[model samples]
Target chain A: MIASAYAVPSVLVFVTSALLILIGALGVISVRNPVHAALCLIMTLFGVAVAFVAQSADFLAAVQIIVYAGAIVVLFLFVIMFLGVDQRAHIHFEPLVGQRAFAGVGVAITVAGLIALMARSHWVTGAVSVSSKLSNGSGNVKELGTAVFTTYLFAFEATSALLVIAVVGAVLLARRERSTTSEEAPQ
Target chain B: MNVPAAWYLVLAALLFGIGAFGLLTRRSALIMFMCIELMLNAVNLTFVTFARTLSDISGQAIVFFVMVVAAAEVTVGLGIVVSVFRRRSSTSVDELSEMKG
Candidate 1:
């Protein structure tokens, strides 16, 4: 069993990640600027990655940081900047007009339903058996790699194919057609 | 103090609700994207909490796939935003109403 020294850091990591997540979620809604919203999203993504690490999913954490915070968000910022869209030119916020009431009622009913279901379910107190497969194995890159290649080979291949389709579709959609209007055409 | 998994689930639920509110109220495409990211992160938190409680690695594996799909989505979403901006010179969701089929 790991000592308290190891456990303390993990606890600290979880607390900080949860705090950051809440802060980021608030920032996402409160900020009016689009760039600032995207930056808040980056913070949220980083917090989530830390949470993953604390859960002993080191490989998943790395993937979260690299794929989400590193690549996807940067791409978003680049496109926002490239488009040169004015942040404040046409600001508009529609009046709630009964929608808020409807939303509140919907949320209340959903919460009531969830509470009733929780009251009825016995799974919360049921005996949980730790699977033998992961008993001794550390959730490191090595274990993940072996599992992905052997047990999850089909799923991995499917993901690759989906990625390929995404790339092709993005390329086709991103192509900008040149205007052929006779404004000194070919001059 | 040791926090229980239920606390994390409650936090995730709150974040999800906030994201949904933003999605409903916001008119900016970029803001909407941020809200979508919030929702995704909320789901990710739920995944992590379950993974911790069950002591299983499968939930983390699902999170890995979710992150991949999110990346692909952002790429495509930003591309569409750029194209919309090029045509209309704005990123407001209301302005795109004319382009609706």
Candidate 2:
């Protein structure tokens, strides 16, 4: 009786997020233009952020939007513009012989396997129900901060290191000049 | 009130499959990269769903790291893509098949 406040809104949020995610995913794959696909990817990222919010992981939702949509996708677009790779790619061509056929088979197998596994396992069952771990009577961001800095401190530090290395590597890779024009010629 | 958690899980699975299909079928380096991002997002959905179902906070925390790793991957990957495009002036995997020996 009293839970409807939570239930009804959650149901609405869930439906909206799900639809947006599916549509965006399809658009990303089916859209011919790279720019359009990037936009679709943004939609999908936003949809996922909504789903996170619905689940009460408010911190994650925010981070998802900031990091993924704001930074990552923007980086993708920057690279696309810089490389001029936004020109239409050979979407129809299968680089490897019979790869499309193989991909089709792989998709079927993966879908069937996932469905069967989920049906057989109790992992999805309502075991513990939703808890306030994210908020923990304080605030969403605070709980996340405590968990990350205290319990997952090592992992948090490791991520910082990894990010540093990745940034350096990206800069180095992007800065290197093509050695020889003749070497650039396709064999 | 009982939106079965399985529904979310199933949605994640479907999203993953779609992402995989895109990854396999698409040849554009950028589009393929976008497809990979789709797959990662699907995994994040699954994590959040389980975090809710199991009443655990670790899943969400893990999702944070996943986002971090994904950001790093995009940075490095796009750099490589840019380099390759500069060298060969093409992003098509078939056209960039220089190591097909």
Candidate 3:
């Protein structure tokens, strides 16, 4: 079938999420203020969470909301406010001549190529699932937990190490040290 | 009938393209970081769709890990940005030309 008719609810959900995502994405880049961009980021993230729900990725949808929209966007706003760079700066002042035009063309080409490949090839060929069948609906959390703790046990443990390292690195990088010499002062 | 995977795929591609364009064109390091987040979400959407198609839970598990990694990356990345902003009052990449070779 060239195109299949879909359920009304599903189509509506998809359309809603797509609109939120695209409009918010455009807002992010087009907006001059970093604060506005961060707000746009939250809108885009909520749209992603909606899509996740439509796809039966219930857990991810929740995580997407909590982790992405809640935590991540807040962190971005914190940085923005802390830096006091919340003014509405000019968005069209391109450092490189025609940089926006070139970027737009390049991205259009890449997205077109991606869609073409998907259309032509036997796209996203399904392999025999090793983990449990994505157990649907309310069971997602259990299934996800089991998979993380069992099949991906090592990877799960390694994430802890990664998080620790990241925290230490962030603290080290963000820490301010008063310079002993005038030359070392932030000039 | 339900929405096809192709539809979702196309949407993800568009999302990714938008993110890439923003990354390429945006001058602010903070805005660029937000664009990167958009790209990551697009990839995550694709992963979740494939997880449904393949009936595999591993994809969701992988998304979990991806979120963790993304969090870590943002933590370190923002720290660097803050430190850089401390030295240079501006967040615009155009101003930081000292490393240009």
Candidate 4:
């Protein structure tokens, strides 16, 4: 990388995003109201977008806002309103004994292991610009678009099929009446 | 121009850990779904970090696919949630453990 530390502005950006992410994540879990949780989720997504911009992923940042905050969270809110499950859950009820304790322990261990692994890896050759130099500014969108169209063309096309399948499957699953045997037999 | 990749990596790790905790501890299916999205974002952040570090555009491309897949997954997953809610008026995972043979 350039150095052990970056510009003060960059560091501030990182700190701000990190705060947004952690606080929003905590809010998502601890908040009893599902609707509030969804709002908090938007905060987390925006935070990730900020981090994306900090890393020069301006295109992804835009997609993050447009797709995630724009579409997905709205879908979540729609489902919550449609089902009327928007009320607060009973967070104090421990139906499963010691579940939170065990989960906390496991997640802590996993995070520590991941951090240690990253530290020991030989990724010290960081930012060598091996493939395409990610020159910031106007080049980001062009670079990402070219990669999606050229190298990942097949996968990109496959996603269209996947989206269609998901749509069909969602309709089938959420239909008001289940025919059981055949769709044509139903009134 | 940017921070060290390691900083981003560590941040993502913490994000993943938080998501994992929420997924495990939260019994509400909707909240669990949100946690899964949280974890997915963490991984996407990592991909973007590497995309910058290696100066490889492919990492960003993969993130694009991941986003598409995530959207599709949520669509189907929420449909299943709606159907399940239709059968039982509650959204808690504790009530859906009937298949534990």
Which 10 successive residues of model 4 chain A have the least lDDT summed? Answer: A122-131
Report, for candidate 3, the interface RMSD: 1.1
Docking class of 2: medium
Ten-residue stretch with the least lDDT total in model 1 chain A: A127-136
Write candidate 4's Cα lDDT for A62-86 as tens digits.
Answer: 9999999999999999999999955
**Candidate number achieving the greatest TM-score relative to the actual structure:** 3
Evaluate every candidate with DockQ and list the scores: 0.46, 0.64, 0.80, 0.73
- Per-residue lDDT tens digits for candidate 1, residues A4-106, read 5345665677678878887887787778676777788888878888776666677888888888888877887887777764567333445546665576567
Assess every candidate by TM-score.
0.82, 0.87, 0.93, 0.92
Q: How far is each candidate from the true structure, as Cα RMSD in Å?
A: 4.4, 4.7, 3.3, 3.0
In every candidate, how many clashes are there?
Answer: 0, 0, 1, 0
C-alpha lDDT (0 to 100) for residue A61 of candidate 1 = 80
lDDT scores in order? 0.70, 0.82, 0.88, 0.89
Local error of candidate 3 at residue A178 (angstroms)? 1.4
Per-residue lDDT for A87-115 in model 2, tens only?
55656766589887898799979988998
Q: Which clashing pairs does model 2 show?
A: none
- Please give the TM-score that candidate 3 achieves against the real structure: 0.93
* Residue range B40-84, candidate 4, lDDT tens digits: 999999998888878788778889999999999999999999999
Off by over 4 Å in 4: A1-5, A86-88, A122-131, A137-139, A178-187
After TM-score superposition, what is the CA distance of residue A65 in candidate 3 from its true location, in Å? 0.9
* Candidate 1 residue runs with Cα over 4 Å from true position: A1-11, A89-92, A95-132, A135-138, A179-187, B99-101
Give the winner by lDDT: 1 or 2.
2
